[model samples]
Target chain A: MTALTPPATVTADGVIVIDHLTKRFGPVLAVDDLSFTVRPGRVTGFLGPNGAGKTTTLRILLGLVRATAGTATIGGSTYAHFTQPMRTVGAALEAASFHPGRTALDHLRVYAPQAGVSDARCREVLDFVGLGPVANRRAGGFSLGMRQRLALATTLLGDPQVLLLDEPANGLDPEGIAWLRGLLRHLAAEGRTVLVSSHVLSEVEQTVDDVVIIARGALVHSSSLAALAALAEPSVRIASPDAAGLTRLIELAGWADRLEPAASTRPGVAVLHRVTAAEIGARAFAAGLELHELTPRDVGLEDTFLRLVGEGAIPGVAEPRLEGVVR
Target chain B: MTAALRTEYRKLVTTRLWWILLASMAAYMAFLAGIMAFALTQDPGSMTGGAPGVEAAPMTPESVARTIYTLATSLGYVFPVIVGALAMTSEFRHQTITPTLLAEPRRTVFLAAKMLSSVVVGLLFGIVGTVSTVGAGAGVLALMGEPTYLSDPIVVRSAWLSVVALTVWTVVGVGFGTLLTNQVAVIVVVLAFTQFVEPILRIAGGQFDWSEGMSKYLPGAAGEAITGSSFYADSGMAAGLLTSWQGFAVLLGYAVLFAVVGRVTTLRRDIT
Candidate 1:
């Protein structure tokens, strides 16, 4: 029942800092000694599989669930200790409902005053999430996607500088997904920290600036998305009239590792080793090989994610019992 | 804390269920009053039991006050209890507690706001319902050639004190609701214990003088003490029940105990 000590620093720029947080549900270690920092002004995608403990970690950070053995702080204070929590950190942990009989406007109206937000802010947030027209409608009849939008609007009511959303895109349509992505980027642009957890890595592939992937209740990789992309092996596709000559040139260049030929649809084409396309083109030019086309096949985020989780690139830990569920 | 209380009050006022319950309370009380007025007007001699010159004891202030007290004390206990239970249970059932806690992370503020709103609405509805019962009953009684007036001190005091008791009852129900955290459980337990078990125990206790002392401590007896009518005393059980202040103190003690326990449980437990 004792409260944890506050962290050393509380700043708007330091959105969240976790120091070896651990949470256990009975015998199950839901989240292990997981530590990561989410910087301000970027969408940090908390990437993990279904049982990878992403939600558990977020719940611990929000103080919704007590950590069994470590501390997490936001703005240098535990979430429960924040005097004005709404203005400091806005979180939507799960899809929770308001009374179905209450109108959308009434729902926010009741909660807004407690957060010290003006009534006008409720309408503004509704409009911000494109829920203005249905503001007066009863929330019980709203579609799941509409509820998702309202939930987001609820989080935005206090105009918090940090946002934590768990699987926000779960029920969104394509247009809604695009809107959310743009909205997240817009929030980040305004120097607000946004941490969004999603099982679908492809959805956040373009939306997030950085990612912290976890598997089996432990960190697997923590780096910028661009850095992960750079670390991925590249593929080079080359189309040439003299395919054999180009293959011989690639072999001579000692880039024969993991080389495979192109499909028949592109006749006289040789897909060279899993090296950067620029390097393959540079070698072809040096060998005086005639090349009709050279295209670099960018690695998909799914591949990088699988590689990280599968390879257990995380710094430390014993094998977890739930490792099979991570993939 | 004030802002949170305002929000809670606003929510309770705007909720359609609260309005529906209020209307139902009024209708039930009015219906009962109408029945009494009709019976008294139609058969004027029945009330006086054929006493010579009794001639339909003309709906005196005491009679009207008695009716108002009976309705208020009885229905007052039931309606406020239901309303208070719903106030908290609805949030839990609808999963609105998560957002509410998020908005006001200090659990104490949320519970206090809810308690304040319940007290205000309970008292307001109690007064409105009591006054309507007396007014409607008096009107019908007068139209039926029987006279009743609000000027009687006892009638006025009964109406006012009923409001206080109803408010206290609402908070008690809310405390039970918080402790149980289940709407059905609170309703069932409150209804069964207050209506059936307490009266039976009071009766059984009367047969045995040793148990008579315990009977006065029952909720029904304590509640009757506030309304200035002892059903057990009339039934030949106890000589005297608790005084008004003593009864109020007992009810308040029960409410505060439950409320504190509920508040502590809500603060310590996970929102999920």
Candidate 2:
């Protein structure tokens, strides 16, 4: 209520607690007893497969959907408890969550009052999102990228302490993605808790401070980005003309328990985890196995995400990629 | 609540639907009233049965008010109802309800604000239709040297009641919108019931002794009571409808019934 600070009823540090949250739609369990906490002053990535209940959870947290059991709270209070919720939280669930006939400014105008924000602030947020040029453009005519910016502008209109964005980079070009990355980082630096959900691993890798990855309506992994990065162990990848001989020699040498199976590569390539390339090269020479390809592999966040959700986790659905359209 | 009201008001004005429906209703009522006045002036005893309501009523100043009230209710009620329906339906249709509920997650506050703002729109439509119909009716009366005493008690009472009836129609429409989120289905059902189904039922009810009592409780019949206007002795319809106050209470009940059910469902159900 005072100046720019959030109300006293709001959790002091903006900690979002999803405690034993469960949701059911007839026979389908959309969210299955999920629990996680999003800390303040950090960007938390809400990652999941397509039907992993990411959107449902977000909707529940925002009070757009009724939870069958458990609770999702912001700062120890439910979203509906806040007299002016926008003052405490700003969520951009989707870019298309606006009337098509309304212009960008008019769309913001509709919610600005509800958020206890001034008209000037709406314009400021629009300019902040680089959408000032087309402020008067109707949303129906806006491309997905522009609409995304408009949605972001709406989130900032309240000057909220917490933000929940779903797939913020979904329709953005590389530059727009980069811009959003910087924007999220800047907002986190300003002491706001930002939870952005995305199915794309690489897109959220560098931007997020922590990751809470879910698959098939269950949490696979939840850890800080730094911890996950540190856990991504480098491996030794080798392909040789006498690949069977090399595999035999490596297995005989007893590097790690077992090598990760190679795919579609001739000469039977092998990737050895927790092994040095120099040691493999030395051992392969000693065994007289002529190597065609011997390379060191630096593990990335994407690899960690893929391994957690895993291949064939959901039947008839493609596994998340470590190196995809993301640059 | 104030912020929510402002948001709903802003939403109503930003779209073209509100203004377009308002104008159409006003224009349609004005033309209908003018044509009825001209036809009646041509032959004062032209009470020869054609249109059911105009059959036995004599051309008089009091009848002018009745004509305006009846035409506004019978011919122009659709506009306000549609405006109300679209006001609620558009939020769900365009997915704007996500943002709306997100901003202020309390369902009752949001629903209440929307419902109240729709009443304002209903009032506007009713006012416009009343004025247009009265203007045309009075002008025709003057041209034919008939009485133009629009200040007669019946005209005065009927004018305001017409506005009230229109407002109730809209409030009930909001209820229907909430009950059925699918805009196309709601529109088709409402149009079918009002234009074809309900009228046919009323006509058949008028012919039978047992079913005639059931017609009094129909929404249209309730609307007539609220407007405080009833056809004369031989308008090809029964005059044994609910009293004016009784009709007001009935429409009020319908509004509360539809709106409460819709609001409760919206509150409990997920927005997906």
Candidate 3:
């Protein structure tokens, strides 16, 4: 087996083809003509606002909900048509309950046979998620974080090449989040296709390689994280004893077009034109102006996400609102 | 298929409701037997004044055995129906069907496994109910100087066939539960049809010759046919009422019809 296998490295070429997928619940269109490709070996963050059809699209892709219009195929087959689905795609859509009275080991035991997973593999996955010690305990009393870990463990039981997780970090603490980031990275390194959907843009910033954003049941932006960040103009913040003098110097330097005062009550601080920190600093020094601080603010993923999804996308299309719950 | 069946069995075994239902069935059988035993121990001589009336006969092992079989089979169906209904309804109540369907994907396999498991559990409960009734009856009848021997083929066959009848009845309940997919609705429909409507129809069928054919198809009347009893003895149709084999076939047909309807509904409907 070892000699016949080549090294596992996910290429950017593996694509998830979603074509003309549409789903409607009465008057509301949950997912409307939504289409996107999540490439392999890259952590693709599916970002959207509270009711932007993120979860609905994922459900349709998983074949949990039938689409009203189109098709979502993974590796050229719908999830329902896959003969060895567990081996092809591992999905964790929601925090599912295994009989509350059953121990964790027993819970997995019932599913392992159907998934074609062995007993040893169950132990391996349990160990992977750090739940080996609590394997014999009833899952009813498990903490939310532990339940999330167990769900992840169940998802990994099939050793699938593709992963589709919806809000995998919802209940996790910071340390758990960090652990998840590492685990996802490790999985990607092993050439698996990992797709994660979350509204928390900051949480996925360092973890995801690319992003596919949607709003109002429509695609907003789809691109690499770096490319999206590069579109953001650099803003400079200057703190000086002489605000007037700094303003004059900045105007003379031909960077006064985008200049604005800093929105703070403190005196002697002004926001300058959207220019690089280095350029502003050199000009201030050249004009003999005293500058206490000159800092560059790089746009974060959150800024890009909000701007693309909140401001750019069309309004008034009703996506399924997760009432009183973070879905 | 075996894996699915195993999982279903595991789920049923682990559920507290299953155990409670089993205990309830046992308790009901014990209660029925206790009443019969108490009645059998009473002096038949005192009631008849040591004289034989035209319509009355002395209690015998065969007569008591027949009564026990009738009581056990008739009363035994309630528990199995309740158990079967809860088995399917709990998945919907707990919202566990989503994960189950996601795991299996093939809807038919999951449903078939559940149906088989329900039938097996129903069969087991039937046997337990029959044994408890017969054991109680035999012990009481023996003490009363009317001993029933195990070698009597008719009595043995009655007990065994009672089990078969009870199993088929439970499967019918399972099918109804699957079709309705609501615990309250299924239970209500089952109780209404079996208790009030069927009995009234059978009484009407006995009085009116035109309705006799219709009454024969009613579940309770059909059930009576299996137990070798006729709800309409005055109609003269009781003597030619369905034979045991025919009764078995009719019961099986009811079970099969319900099962197919349940299966189709389960497969076509959205689990959520």
lDDT of each: 0.76, 0.81, 0.72
- lDDT by residue (tens digit), candidate 3, B54-142: 12345564645565655556555777777877777767765567666767777778777877878788888888877887777676667
DockQ of each: 0.44, 0.82, 0.38
In candidate 2 the C-alpha lDDT for residue A198 amounts to 92
Best by lDDT: 2
For A32-98, candidate 3 gives per-residue lDDT tens digits of: 8988888877899999987899888887777777888989988777878766566667788777556
lDDT of 2 by residue, B135-211 (tens): 88778877888776676776778777888888888888887888787889888988898878876777667667898
Worst 10 residues of 2 chain A by lDDT: A1-10
Better of 1 and 3 by TM-score: 3
**DockQ-based class of model 3:** acceptable
User: For candidate 2, what is the DockQ?
Assistant: 0.82
Residue pairs of candidate 1 with colliding backbone atoms: none
**Residue runs of model 1 more than 4 Å from their true location after superposition:** A1-14, A234-298, A310-327, B36-64, B139-149, B230-240
Instruction: Score every model by TM-score.
Output: 0.81, 0.91, 0.82
Q: How badly does each model clash, as a count of residue pairs?
A: 0, 0, 0
Instruction: Answer with 2 or 3, whichever has the higher DockQ.
Output: 2
lDDT assessment of candidate 2: 0.81
